[model samples]
Target: MYSTRSSKILFFHITIISLFSFSIVKPIQAEPYGMAGCGLGSMVPVWKNDIGQVLAATTNVSFSSQTFGITSGTSNCTNDGIVKQKMAQEVFIAYNEGPLELETTKGSGERIRAMASLLGCPTHANELGKLMKEKHSYLFAKSNLENEFRSKEILVRLKSQIALDDSLKYICKN
Candidate 1:
């Protein structure tokens, strides 16, 4: 029973609120699945548009493919959570290279603590920092490499060192 003008205003308000809600939502990290979410549907090339998302969602729900994929680790799903954790660590190291380097050299800092937490040993941050301090030269030896490559190298060396140490090997998850 609404008039045309009121109906138009109501539609406008709804549209604006929907847009505002979407704007406040943070993007998913690492996973690039669009509006359709992760599944066989997300792998489809057409999922970039709204209509494509509807189709992709339909395909997902109709087949129950997303649930199957998630349960069985197929269709862009991974059962190995370690891979995501490692990726997060890599990103953290790459972004905080300078602070990490300084902390590693000094054998303690907020960055070192954060890194220890990322490596799954929050309580042993000091010990991890000390280890880094001991291996400062070895860990930072690849400084001549590009930034991305250098961070990767540092990660490899750090993990290797951690693996060698009895205490760290038992405690560290990564």
Candidate 2:
């Protein structure tokens, strides 16, 4: 039979071990829409916190122009490049709204193609889509999306990747 002292010692050891183990385990969190889609990447040249502020001002001004155009019964949306850009925005929005993984699967095909089209790379869309698929993890999943530092790290890495490729380099500027 175990003595009371031994039992208490065992209980203490188990408690200590449990606490130590729990402290080391971290949950795998899903990254936010920013990293999952190129939301954060787009802000590049601009950091994370400022991206929203800048976007807010730009959106307001852009909306004012759009509204004026609408009231005047003119929409540049019908223009060739503008039409493709609208399609690209739809894809980008869909990526931000949908599950993170969906960005990898569906996006690698249509979304990338849309982006390429918007960037005037229609002929190279398929190739770009294939490359985006191949690089999805580094481009999306590798970072803890909630951490701006980590997001920026991956974004820089992604930027370098884009910079290195002629077909994808132009997006780095935008």
Candidate 3:
């Protein structure tokens, strides 16, 4: 048997954890599977914790509170986990396709870093930032080719980083 005082204390502890968990739960691994076979986005940890959403639509007037989703039919929306997987896959394809250079000296590099950061790969982001810092002259028409080479190099590097970084594995498994 628990006394009223102890019950209150336990309840308070749980309340604190629940409130704080929302801020960080997004970093937790998303659906083990990418969005493909998953039941819905509502089931994704990122969807529920990082974003507040409504799990289902209702015709009858009723108020309900839920974590993550704000819309009813958004269950199939791509979540962070899926985004990471897609990013990895895109890089993989680019690495092989040989249009290969990314324009790391421009906005494209920044976008890559941003994607890495969102995917929980700060190390990769820093490495990408460094690559963009390198200066090189671009020829009028040949400049495009050089830029593509640099970008491709960066994506391949990111592909390797995902292989080594533990945090990155959650999003880019295999």
Q: Total clashing residue pairs per candidate?
A: 0, 0, 15
Q: Each candidate: what lDDT?
A: 0.80, 0.48, 0.42
Superposing all C-alpha atoms, what RMSD in Å does each candidate have to the true structure?
12.8, 20.1, 15.1
lDDT of 3 by residue, 1-174 (tens): 999999999999999999998877766454443323223433445434322233322211122211111112133434445434444444333332322135444424544454555345545665543433332122111324454464445445555655564545565433
Tens-digit lDDT track of model 1 for 1-174: 999999999999999999999999998655466777656787887576889889888887777676555545677756477236676577567767887888889999988887888788999999999999999999878557887777788899999999998899999987
lDDT of 2 by residue, 22-104 (tens): 99999975333232122223223342355654663354244443322222224322333432443333333333323433545
Ranking by lDDT: 1, 2, 3
Better of 1 and 3 by TM-score: 1
Model 1 — which ten-residue stretch has the worst lDDT?
A: 79-88
Candidate with more favorable, higher lDDT: 1 or 3: 1
Better of 1 and 2 by lDDT: 1
- Clash tally for model 3: 15
Most accurate candidate by TM-score: 1
| Clash pairs detected, candidate 1 | none
What's each prediction's TM-score? 0.54, 0.35, 0.26
